[model samples]
Target chain A: MNKYILSKKLYRNELATFYSFLIGFLIALAVGSLILFIQEKNPFDVFSLMLKLSIGSVNSLSNSLNKAIPLILAGLGISIINSVKLWNIGAEGQIFMGAIALNFVYINTSINNSQIYILLLLVSGFLGGAFCIFFPAITKVLFGVNEIITTLLTNYIVFGLTIYLINGAWKDPASLNFPAAAYVSESVYLPTVLGKLSSGFLICILFTLIAYYIKDKSVFGYEMRIAGGSELTAIYAGISAKQKAFFAMLIGGGFAGLAGAIELLSQTHRVSTGISQGFGYTAIIVAAITGMRPIGIFLVGCLFGALTIGGSVIQTIGVSSYIAEIIQATTLFGALVAQFFFSYEILKKDEND
Target chain B: MIDVQLMGLLNATLQAATLLFIAALGELITEKSGILNLGVEGMISVGAVSGFITAINTESLFLAVIVGVLSASAFSSIHAFVTVVLKQDQTVSGLILTILGLSLSSLIGKPYVGKKLEVKLESLIDIAEPSNIFQVLLSQNLIFYIAILLMIFTAYILKKTMFGRRIEAIGEDLKSADSMGLKIAKTQFIATCVGGAFAGLSGVYLTLSYVPYWTDGMTSGRGWIALALVIFGGWKPYRTAFGALLFGFLEALGPRLQTYGFEMSPYIVKITPYIITILVLVFLTIIKNGNTGAPKNIGIPFFRENR
Candidate 1:
C-alpha cells in the first residue's frame, strides 16, 4: 500500500461540503448507536423509534417544525456573524433579553389590536437581541476585545437579569412563589397555522430568504465576505472591517433575540427560566453543520428539531433526552473533521512523486 | 464576631479562587500554544462527573483525580487533532467539544447524580487552633496548595524554560517558528492536553473537595468565568491568579453577605463578576492601547502546506 499525503485544493469544491455532511451525519448515527448499545438498549429499535417520533406523523412533524423556527432564526443570526469570522455565542442570552423585552412591552402596553401588538412585540424582540450584543460589538470594534469571551460572559449577565426580573418586577402575582412572568396577552400571541405550528414558521422562512438574498446576492454581503476574509484586504478594498463586523454581530444578535420572542409568543406564552432550552448554543451546531448557508440552515434546523423531538420521545423508553445534544455535538465534530478533507485532497505517493 | 466572619470569608474566597485559577491556568497554557479551546466548560464537566463517580466507587481521591485528568486529557485530544492536524476552526470545534462534553457527562453521569462520595480531600494543615490570618489561609486542602504551586510552576515555565519559549514562539508567529525547526503540531497538541489536564484537576477539586457531590450543571458557569479570568488577568499566571481570587471574593461575598443580613439581591451579586470582566477588558484595552497580551495566533489554525 502506498502512503497518501494531503494536498491543498486550489479551488473551492461545493460537493465537498455535501459529502462531508453526509459522512459526518452517518458517523454521528454510529456514535449514537454505540451509546445506545452501551446502555443495554437496541440501537436499531431506538433509532427507528426516534425516527418515527420525530417525523413519523403529521402532528409530530409539525411539532418538529415548530421547534425548528427558533433554530433557523438563531442559526441564520449566527451564520451572518460567522461570515465575518465573528463568534456570537451569546445568542442564549440574547434570546433571554428578547423574551424579557417582549414581556416588558406586554406588561406595560394596553394595545388591543392583534396585528399591531404582534408587530410591536416582534420588533422589540429584535431590538432586544441587538441591544444585548451592543456592548460586545462595540468593545470588539473599538477596544479589540475578544468577542467570543465577551459574548459568552454576557449570557451569564443576561441570565442574572432575567432571574432578577422574574423574581422581582415581572413576577406574576398568580404564579404563587414559582418564578416566572405573567402570560402574554392573547392579542399579541402568534396565530397558529396548524397543530402546534405557529405563524412564526412563515416569519422564520421569510427571514431566511431575506438573509439568503442579502448574504449571497448583495454588495453588503460581498463587503462582509471581504472584511471577514482579511482586515488588510478589506481596507485595501475600501470596506470598513470594523463597521461591517459591528453590524453583522448586531444583526446576529437581533436574529437570536427574535428567536426568543417568537418562542415566547408562539409556544410558551410566558417568560420562564427554561424558555431557551439551550436553543442558542444548539444553533451554533446547526449553523456550523450547514456551512453557514441560509437555505442549508433551514434544512439542518429542521433535522435538529426532529432530533430534539426524538430526544423527548425516547425519554419514554428510559433514555435521557441529552442523547439529542450528544448526537448533535458529535455530528458537528464529525463534520469539522470531514470539512478538512474538503480543503485538502488525498494524493498517493506515486502521484506526489 | 467580625474577625471570625472575615476569616471565613477569606477561606471561602481562596476555595473559589483555587477552582478558577486551575482552569484559567490550563486555558492560558493552551492559548499560549496558539490554540483556543472554548471546550474548557465541557472538559470540566466530564472531569467532574467522571471524578465524582470514581470517588464514589473506588473511594480513593488520588485515583479519582487521575481518572478525571486522564479522561479530560483524552477528550481534549479530539480538539487537538481537529484543530492542529485537520486545520479546522478552533472556535467552532471547541464550542462543539463543549456541547459534546457536557452532554456526554450528563448522559453517563445520569446514574451517579445525587450519590455521595465517602472519600474527600481534607485540609493538609488542619490546625486545631489558628492564631493568625496566615494560619487561616494555610488551613486549606492539599489541592489548594497544589494550585498555588501550579501557578508558580506555570509562571516559571512560561518565563524561563525553553519549552515555554517554543510555545510562545509558535503562538506569536508559527511561520517563523516553523522556519526555526520547532515542532508546532506536537507542541500545540501537548499544550492542549496539559490544558485539559488542568481543567480536569479543577473539576476533581470541585467534586472531591469543594462541594463533594455530583449535580447536573454543578460547574454552572465557572468554566466560562475561568475563561474570562484568563483575559481579565491579561494572560499572565500571577495576574490571572490574582484576578481569580478577586472574582472568587465576589463569589464568596454573596452568601456571606446574606448571612450578615445584607439585603443585596443574589442576582445582582451573581452578575457582578461578568460585568466586571467586561469592564476589565475595556480598561485593559484602553490602558494598553488595545495591545492586550493575547497570543497573536491564538485561534488561527496552522496549515503548513498552505503557508
Candidate 2:
C-alpha cells in the first residue's frame, strides 16, 4: 500500500529549458549518428562533412541564411500564435497560399517599377495566407470549433488548389512541360546583400525585432498572454478573449504568407509545387525549441537552415537528406521531456503505516 | 454493365472505408482514454514501410502485419512515455511523434522504394467466378472481414464493457477517475498503443492488399483524415465507421466518376475528403453548440497533485 505524488515546483527553473534543449539537441545528434552508422557510413566523417558544408565558408553560410529566411518568418508566425496557446499547424498550407497569391499578382499586374511590384506582391501574399486561415479562425470563434483540425484540413485544400493552379491556369507555356508559373520579371528579383545572401535575411531579422516587441513588450501581447492563460481572467480584465485569438491567428497566417512571398522573390523566382519544402512544418519545431522567443527563433532558424542545406549536400555521399528531419523531430521530443522536468517532480510517499 | 460498375464502386468504397475505419477506431480508443496522439500519419507511414520491408524480406503477410503493428506500437510508446509519464503537452508531444515517425520511416524506407511485395492476402471467399453482388462483396481479403468484426467488437466494448467505461471515465474526468482507484496512466498508455496498432494494421492492409508495393510518402494524408473522422463521428464507434464509409465513398467516386464520363478534375476529387471534414466539423459544432462528444479531459496532461 503506497502512494506517490507528482508536484509542480514553486519556482520555475529558467535554466532548465536551455539545458534541456542542449541535451535534446545532443540526443538528436546521437540518434542521427546511430542511423548513419547503421547505413554503414562513417558517422564522424558524415557529421564533420555536414558541419563543414553548412557553415564552413561565407558562400555556404549565405546559402544557409537564404534557406533560413522563410523558416525564421514562419517560425515567428508560429511563435506568435503559440504564445496565445493556439495550434496553427497549417503553416505549410499558408505558405502555399501566400505563394499562390503572389503569383496571382504577378500574372495580373503589368507594373514596371519592381519595388512597387514587390510591395504589392508581399501584401497579396499576406492577404492570401490570412484568407486561408480566416475560415478556421472565424469558425473557432463563432462555433467553438477546434482550430487545430480546421486549420490542418485547410492545408490539404490549399495543397489541392495549388496543384490545380500550377497544372492549369498558371502553367507556363515556355516552361517546356513543367508544372509551374512563369518567372517574375528580372527586376523583381530581390537584390543580394552579400555572397548570394538575399536581402531577405535582413528582412527576417527586422521581422524578429518587431515580433519580439509585439510579443514581449506590447500591451496587446500582455492581454493576449492573459487570454491564453485564462479566459475568465482576461474577461475580468476587460479583454476580449475571442478577439485576441482571432487577430492572433490572422497575424500568424500573415507571417507565414510573408515568408512565402519573400521566398518567391528572393530565391525561387517562380511559384512551383516545391516552393515550400516543409518550411512551415519545420518552423513549428524551430518555434517550440526556441520557447517562442523571437530572437531564439532567428538563431535556431539559422541552425536548422544550415542542417537542411547540409542535408542536401550530403546526398552526393549517398545519404538520405531526411536525416535532418529526423534530428529535428528528435530534438523536439527532447525539448518536450525537458519541459516536463522543468515544471514538475515526482516524490515517493508511504501510506497507511 | 451498370450493375458491374456499381459493384465495382461499392467494392472500392468498402476498401477505402476499411482503411479509415481501422485507424479512426484506434484513435477513438486513444481519445476515449484521454490521449490525443496526432502522430497517426507518422505511425501509418512507419507501419506501411516497416510492413512492406518485412513482407519483402520474410515473404509472409502474417508476419508482416505483426511486425507492422508491433513497430507502430513501439513507436507510439514514445508518445505515451512523454505525455503520460512526463506530463508534457499532448498536442505538442503528439506532433513531435508524428515528425519523428514520418522522417524515420522515410529514412528507413529509402532503400525499399519501388519494391513490391510478392506475398498477398487472398480473398476469404474462393469464388473463382462470382455470379452475384453478395458473392463479390464476400470475396474481400481476410482483413476486410476482420475490420467489420472489429467495428462490431469496438461498438460492443464501448457500450457494454467495464474496460470501455474505464477509458471513458479517464477521458471525461481524469482527476475523479484517479481518485476513484482507476489506473489513469496505464489506461491512457494502453489506449494510445492500441491506437498505434490499428494504424499499423491499416498500413499493413495498404502494403499487403491495397497496393502491394512500397513508396515514399505513400500514406499521404490519410492519417489526418482518420483524425477528422474521429471528430466528425462525435467519438462514437458506429458513427465513426459511418463517417469513414462516407469518406471512402468520396475517394472511390473520384476515379469512377472519371470513367463514367464526368469532367471533374482529379485534384478536385482529391480534396473532397478534406473539404467535407471541415464542413462536417462546422456543421457538428453548430448543431451541438460546440458540445461534440469529445472527452472533457482529452489533451490535458493529468497530475493528481495539481488538483
Candidate 3:
C-alpha cells in the first residue's frame, strides 16, 4: 500500500510539469508553424534548421551557452526577489549601472590579477545595483509611492545619464562618432573556458547554486518567505514590512548588478549605451515561468539560451528574429492563462457523486 | 523685464499644456471610475505613430487625427476586454500590452523613419512678426482651444451629468452600481475606451500638430507624465489642466534656461520633468496622502462575483 502511494505521488509530480511543459511546447510549435505557413516557408525545414543551429554543432552549443550567461544570472535575480514576494523591475537599470561601473574601472584602473579580477567586477556590480534600489525603496516605504513606476523610470535615468557620460567624458578615442567607452584590458576580461564559452557561464552556475542553497537552506529565506506568504501574519509575529521590502530590494538589486558587471567584463569587455537590452525585464518572465524555483530557472535559462542562439542563425539566414519575439509574447500569454488551471478544476455537476 | 519673456513663455506654456492636459483629463474620468490604465504609454505611442502615418499618407490632417484616435481606441478596446472580460491581473497585462505595442510600432513603423511630410500648419495665432504682443497673445493652435474646452467639459460632466454620477457610484462600489441596475461592463468599457481614445488623440497632437515628424519613442515619457499629472491634479479635471500646464512650462523651461547661457550643467535641467514629478508627488501625498484624495477603488479590479 505504501509503495503504491509513493509511486502515485512520484507519478503526479512528474505528470504535472510534464503536461504543463508539453502544453507550452506544443503551443509554441503550433504558433511558429502558423507564422511560417503565412510566410510560405516550410515549417519542418525551419524547425530542423533551428534545432541544428541551437545544438547540432559544437559552435552552436557554445553560442547558446554564451547567450545563456546573462539570462542565468537574470533568472537568479528574479528567483531571489519573487521568494520575498517583491517584484524587482529595475534589474535593467541595475545591470546598466553595473556595466557603467565596470567600464569606469576598466578605463581607469589597470589590474593584473586575473583570478581576483572576477571578484572585483562582481562586488562592484552588486554595490552599483544596491545603490539604484536605495532611493526607490525609501520612497516606497516612506512616501507610499509605487516602486513599479519609480523603478521603471529609473531605466531612463540610467540611459540618459550613461549616454551623457559617454558622449561628453568617456567617449572611446577610436570609436569616431559613436559614443562607446574604451574596452577593458585583456587581463580584466574573463577567460574563455570551453569552445567560445566565456568563464561567465560558470559564474552564473555558481551564483545560481549559491542562490538556491541560500533560499532553501537558510533562515533568511524562511523569514522572507514567511513575510511574503502572509504580511499580516508576519506583522503579528513582529516582522516589519518596511524592513522586508528594503532587504528584498537590496538583495534583488545586488544579484542583478553582479550579473550586469559580469556581462560587461566577460562578453563585451566594454560599456555601451545598449548594455541592458531588457535583460532585467525579461528576468521577470523567467522568474514567473520557473515558478520562482532556482532549479527550474536553471533549466528555463538554458531553453531561452537555445532559443536566442536559434534566433541568431535565423537572422543570419535573412529573416527577422521577430518570430522569436512573437513566440515569447505568445508564451507569456499562455503562461498567464495556465496559472488559472494550476490549482483549479472545472467539472460538470452531477447528482451522483 | 519679466513681461517680455513671460508672454513668450506663457504662449509656449499654453500650447505645451494643451496636449497632455487632454490626456490627463480623460485619464481622470477613468480613474475616477476606478480603473487605472497603465497601458496609457503604449496607447499614446500607437496614437502618435498612427496619426503621423495617416497624415503623411492621406495628406488630410483631419482624417489623420481621426485615424489616430480610432487606432488607439481599437487598441484600448483590447485592454478593456482583457481586464473586464478575462479578469486577468490588470497591472501585468497592461504592461505586457505596452511591451508588445512598443515592439510592434517599431517593427511596423520602421518604413516611415527619416521621411518628411507636408504638415498642414494650423495657425497658433495670426501673430505679426514685428509685434511682440501678437507673439504672446495671438499665436496659438486650435488644439489648445479644444484642450481647454475638454478640461471644462470633463470637469462639468464629472460633477453634473447622470452618467458621471453613475461612474462615481461604480468607482465607489461596483456592487452598489449593479444593485442599482447599472450595466457594469458597458459603463466601464465605455469609460475605458473614451480614456484610451483621449490618450490616443493626445499622442496624435504630439506628432501631427505640435511636431510633424515620426521618430521612434517620440512620446518620450509624456504618457507617464500625463499619469503623474492625473495624481498631481488630485484627479480633478481643471486641476489636471493646471498640472499639465505646470509640467509644460517646466519642460519648456529647460531649453529657455539653456538658451540664457547660465553655467548650469545640462543634466540638472534635462531631468526637470522627473524632478517636478517627485516634488508634485511629495506635495500631494503630504497634503492628501490619506484616503481623502484618491478614488476609493483606483487600483482594485472589480470582480462580478457578489452582485
Candidate 4:
C-alpha cells in the first residue's frame, strides 16, 4: 500500500499509447484519403478545412457545440455499457424510441398543458430508451443470445418503424405530403441560452456528470467493472452477471432516450425520418475514442460533434460532407488504437534487450 | 391467407431466405469453429457493392457473385487477421470492419448510382415451370439452390465429417483441440474465410435479383436480421431455414398489410419484426435458462500460441 513503492511497480507504456493513436490516424487518413481522391479533391485541403470549420470562428464553435451535445450523451451511454462488458449496439434504436417518446408528449399535449408537457417529455423519453433497450436486456439475461447482434438487428427494425410513423400516423397535417410531424408547442420547447446555441448542450453535460459519479464512486460501478474484467470471478464474488448486464443496458438505453428528448424539445420540435440520420450511431465513435471513460467521453464526444458541424461547413465550401464522415470514422479508428497504450503496460525482458 | 398462395410466397420466401441463408450458413460454420465474425453485415455490404460494380460492368451475374464472395472473403480476411491472428477483440474488430466496409462501400458505390443493370439468368427447369407451387418451391435463382446446397454441405461437414468433429472439438476447448493435433489456425482461418464467402454471396443476391439494382445500403438491415435469425433458429440447419422463412414472412408481411384499407401507420407496423424478435428471444431465453445453445467459444478470438 506504500504510495512510492506502488508508483514504481505500476508500469505505464506511453510509447504504445502514442503509437496506437498515430497508427489509427494513419489508417484513418488512408481510408479517408480514398474518399477524398474519389471526390476529385485534395486530401490535405479537406483535412485542413475540416479542422478550420470545426473550430474556426465563434459562430462555428457554437454550431459545433450544439451538434456535440447529443453525441456526448449517446457516447457516454456506449461507455457505460462497455464498462459493464455488455455491447449495446442498439443506441440507434433507443434514440429513435426516445425521440418518439418525446415527440408523443410534444404532439399530444393541449396548449394549456405546457408545464405538464415538459415533465411528461422527460419521463416519456426515459421510458422510450429504456423500453427499447429492455428487449435486449431480456434476451441477454434469458436466452444468452449475444446482445450485439440482437441489439443491432432491433435497431434496423426500429428504423423501419420510424419510417412507417412519419409516412403514416405522424404525418404533419399541414405539410404538403412530407413525412414529418406537427411542431411541439412553444411552451414545451427547451430554451436556447446562447445565440443560436442549443440548450440540450447542458443536458449532455449533466448526463456526463451522472455517468461519472455512477461509474467512479458507487459500489455497483466497481462491481460492474469487476464483472467485465472477469465474469467467473464476479460470479464467485456473488455478483449477478445477469443483473449487471440488465442494468447496464437499461442505463445505456436511458441515456440515448434522454438524448432523443433533448432533440425533440430543443432542436427540431418534431420527429421526422431525419430524426436518426446517424447521430445515435456516431456516438459509438465518441464512446470508443474516450476510452470508455466519462470525462474522457466528454472531450471525445465534443470533438466528434465538432466534426459533424465542421463537416456541414465543408458542404457549404463546395466539398461534400461525405469527406467529413470519412474523417470522423478514421479519427475514431486512430483514437481507439492510440488510447490502448494508456490502458496497458508494455514489458520487455532483459534477454531481449 | 396461408393456403394456395403458399407456393408464390414460398418462392419469394426462398429467394429472401437464400440471401440471408448463405451468409448465415457461413456465419454458423465460423461460429461453430469458435470465432464470431461481427463484420457479417459489413462484409455483406462490401460484397453487394463489389458484385454490383463488377457484374454490372461485365453483365455476368455469375462473375458478379464470384467477385462478391471473393471480395467479401478478402475484406473478412482483415477481420480474421486482427481477431484471429493479432489477438484483438472479436466484437470490436467485427464492428470496426463493419464501419469501414459500410463507409468504403458507400464511397465506392456512389459512382454506380441511377444506372440500369443487365444480368443473364438461366432458363427455368420445365417440370417446376408449369406448376405454381413447383415454380415457387422448386424453381429459383441458381444462388438460392447454391445456398441450400451450402447449408446441407455445412450440416454434413459439421455433424458427419472428421473435419467437422475437429471444428466442434476446437469450439469446445481450443487447448484440448490443439493438443490433439488439430490444425487450429488453419481450420479457424479456413472456416472464417468460407463463412465470409457465403455472406458475400448473400450480398450478391441483393444486387442481382432482390432489388436488381444498385443503391446505397440496399441490403437495408437484412444482414443483421439474418444474423439474429441464425441465433433464433438455435444454430441448427433445418431450424435456420424455418427461422429464415418465419422472418421472411414477417418482413414481407409489413408491406402486405398495406393492402388493408385502414391505412395503418408505417411506424407501428414497421416495428413488428423487431418486437417479435425481442419477444421470441426473451421467450427462448426463459425456456432455456439463459445458457446459449451456440458454440462455446463462439465470439472468442483464436490464437494457436495462446492455446
- Model 2, B1-307: lDDT tens digits are 7767787788888899999889999999999999999999988888888998999999888899999999998999999999999988888888887778888888888888887667887888776555567977798898898888988998888779999999999999887898899999899999999999999999888888888887777887899889989988999988998999898988888877888898988888888878887898899889999888899989998887643
lDDT of 1: 0.89
Residue A42, model 2, lDDT = 95
Give lDDT per model, in order: 0.89, 0.88, 0.72, 0.75
State in Å the error of residue A17, model 4.
5.6
Query: Residue B228 of candidate 4: its Cα lDDT?
Result: 73
lDDT of 3 by residue, B140-162 (tens): 76666677778788888889999
A210-229: candidate 1 lDDT, tens digit per residue: 88987888898999999999
Count of backbone clashes, every candidate in sequence: 0, 0, 5, 10
TM-score of chain A of 1: 0.95
Model 4 chain A: weakest 10-residue lDDT segment is A1-10
What is candidate 4's lDDT per residue for A30-99, written digit by digit as tens? 8777767777888788778878877787777777887877787778888888977888788888888898
**What's model 2's overall lDDT?**
0.88
* DockQ of all models, two decimals each: 0.77, 0.77, 0.18, 0.39
Q: List the pairs of residues colliding in candidate 3.
A: B124-B139, B124-B140, B124-B141, B125-B139, B125-B140
Superposition-based RMSD of candidate 4 using all C-alpha atoms, in angstroms = 5.0
RMSD of each: 2.1, 1.7, 5.7, 5.0
